[model samples]
Target: MEELLRFGIVGCGSVAAFHAQAIENTSGAVLTACCSGNPQKARTFAAAHGARAFDTLEELLAGPVDAVCLCTPSGLHARQALEAMAAGKHVVVEKPMSLTLEDADRVLAAARQTGRKVCVISQLRFQPAVQAVRQALDAGAFGRLVCANLSMNYYRSEAYYQAGGWRGTWAMDGGGALMNQGIHGVDLLRWLMGPVTSIRASVLTRAHAIEVEDTAAALLEFENGAVGTLTGSTACHPGYPRRLEICGTEGSIVLVEDALVRWDLPIPCPVPVGEGANSGAADPNAIGAAGHTLQIANFVDAVRNGTPLLVDAQQGRQALEVVLGVYASGRTGRTWHPETP
Candidate 1:
């Protein structure tokens, strides 16, 4: 029998709970330890999850674990993943893999150097609707993508940022609405549209007092001659489901909260409809374990079977570059092209 891969959860914040539930539900993995800056919080979270608590990441690194699940702030992902990879542990990072493209590329380079498998948590890729689109794309149903648009016009209350010290800072949380909240859809847009050749964008802090923008908008030109727009805002009061619309020469589909609200494809392409984990469009921490569960399970299987990951470090970096390009375009007021590392 294959040994169950023991896991460690670093940064015992709210996002770690989804990982905790996922480890419990995963067949080839188990939660062995967890770490948090606050000893009391670490102990409490560990006690609740049947894992040993470590007060520091260094201490956790010295302990037994096959992989580390990084649930830290958005800005810390690259550094943490590199540290863990250097320490000989696989890593799984939450979205916006890093705040900057430089950081994302650095992490990717380190992962390659260490030969440590690193996966980013973009669980929407595993969602059924996304899966269907991927399949149809493979089948030539969506021939030559024409245009794509993604929006995350959801709400996040002031209390939401006030709940944690690291919530709305530029250093840790990175950008506000787009970087922190809407990145998943941003990634989905890039994934469906292919690599971007250029982008123009603007970001604002219209509604929040944070160091980052509460709203952002971008226009992108893909390598395939397709153009797209992205709108991400936390100022959308009462919160609506996040939406993604992909238009191709032959077909188009619209998704709201990972659900296919519209499906129009040429030919007999049937999109399989199924529920994924709650993506926490409104509540940042209200995510479910199913998507995380599937991603982590697939990661473990990749480890055990030497298979390719659905979202590896390169894919993660590409998504980060797309988001960062928007920021650059916003600052320069000129279209920016992503620099490949």
Candidate 2:
């Protein structure tokens, strides 16, 4: 049997519970400690997982742990990840890796310098349906890729933003809807379609009275000549199912609510199925937390067997680059290429 990997979880919030459960359930991983700025929450989170609690990350890092899972605010990701890496702990961080590309680069550099593995929490990639779609695309089932469309229309009440001091702020959470919620779909789009060459975008705060834009739409031209449109927003009432559609000369595939809602093509596509996989259903609340266990499972395997990380730290930064490119394009009112930076 592989040796157990002790894990220290920083940030004892709602999302932290998911990581705790995932670590507890995965083989060769033990949730040894939990940390939070709030002492009470940290204690509660640790008790729930049968682990010790610390009021700060420094205390958690002082414990015996092989890795740290950071579920902190988006803006704080870089600093916390770097600290964990510097402590000689492997890190798995929540997405949008950092608020800016520079911070993202810093985190990546730290990982390299420390010679420790760093992974970004992009659990959407673990969804069986999403994996199936990626397989089809990789197998050329989507012959001669043409165009793609991605939409993320989710509602976040004022109470949601006010839940945490860093919720809707640009400095912390990066952007509003695009950074917080739509980033998964955006990353999935890029993962399946390939690198974007240029982007033309428009952004606005349509509904939420936040500093960042609550709604954004963009057109992208891929280096491979494929065109795509992306819409992200928190403006819709009650919200709607996030959807991603990719079309090629042969046919198209649509994934709605994490499931393959539509698959129209003549190609013999093989579906890569897995056990205990979440059915890609359309409940907004259901999809977000469902993939954590699978993600942890994969991470533990990678740690033990030296398997490649499911979502490497650099790929996470690349995904952030695409989102930032859209913002840059929106600001400049001109198509921006990700490669330029």
Candidate 3:
């Protein structure tokens, strides 16, 4: 039998628990060690998952581990990933990979220089609905795509921002709702559609009194001449379901509750991607955790079998560029191009 991959987690916070549980559940993988600034939290997290806990990343890296998952704050990802790569471990980082493109590029360069695999945690790519859309698009079902719409409305209380030191800060969390909350939807938008060519956007902190915008909207133009709109907010009370709609000359499809709850194609199809297929049920609270677990499994499989990662670090950077473009466009009051800087 192949050896079980040993995993180390750096940052034992709320998300870390999900990663720990996922690692514990996945076969051919084991949660060997964990690191966190708070020794108590680390110990609690590790004990619950049947893993050793360390007070610092340095100590964890020195132990036996094949990969390290960086669930640290957004701004800290680049540095932590570099440290892990330097320690001769493959890395998986939570998204918005870095605060700036320069940092994202730096981490990628380090991974290449050190000959380590680095993956960005964009778990939405693992969703059944998303896979269906990708397959349909690839099979020319969405012939000549014309428009796409992405909207994520979720409430974030003031306490949510105050829960951690890095929650609502621009330098740390990158942006507000767009960066921290809605980035998955933003990534899914770009992934199913194509690369964004240009964007005109507007952002503001309308709802909560936070440092970053709680509300944001943007107009997007794709390289393939398709136009789209993205609106995200944590301000809306009794928020609506996160929805994505892709329309083309051929037909359209809609995904609700992270499942292909609605799909209308021009013709009937075989095994409508993940239909009746069990990836398990959708749990909003565990969505990120589920995505993270699937992502981890894929990364480990890729390393062991030489398969491709669902969302590589490079793709993560590209997704970040789209979000940044929206912020930049909103700030400058002009269309921003992802290709530029």
Pick the TM-score winner.
1
Order by TM-score, highest first? 1, 2, 3
**TM-score, every prediction:** 0.96, 0.94, 0.94
Residues 90-111, candidate 1: write the lDDT tens digits: 9999887888877887888898
Pairs of residues clashing in candidate 2: none
Give the 10-residue window scoring lowest on summed lDDT in candidate 3: 274-283
For candidate 3, the per-residue lDDT at 142 reads: 81
Q: Candidate 3, overall lDDT? A: 0.83
User: Which residue runs of candidate 1 sit more than 4 Å off their true CA positions?
Assistant: 269-279
Which is better, 1 or 3, measured by TM-score?
1
Global lDDT of each model?
0.85, 0.83, 0.83
RMSD of 1: 1.7
Relative to the unseen true structure, what is the C-alpha lDDT of residue 84 in candidate 3, on a scale of 0 to 100?
A: 89
Clashing pairs in 1: none
Expressed as tens digits, the lDDT of each residue in 164-201 for candidate 2 is 88988888888988888888888898888888988999
Q: Please give the TM-score that candidate 1 achieves against the real structure.
A: 0.96
Segments in model 3 whose C-alpha atoms lie over 4 Å from true places: 269-288
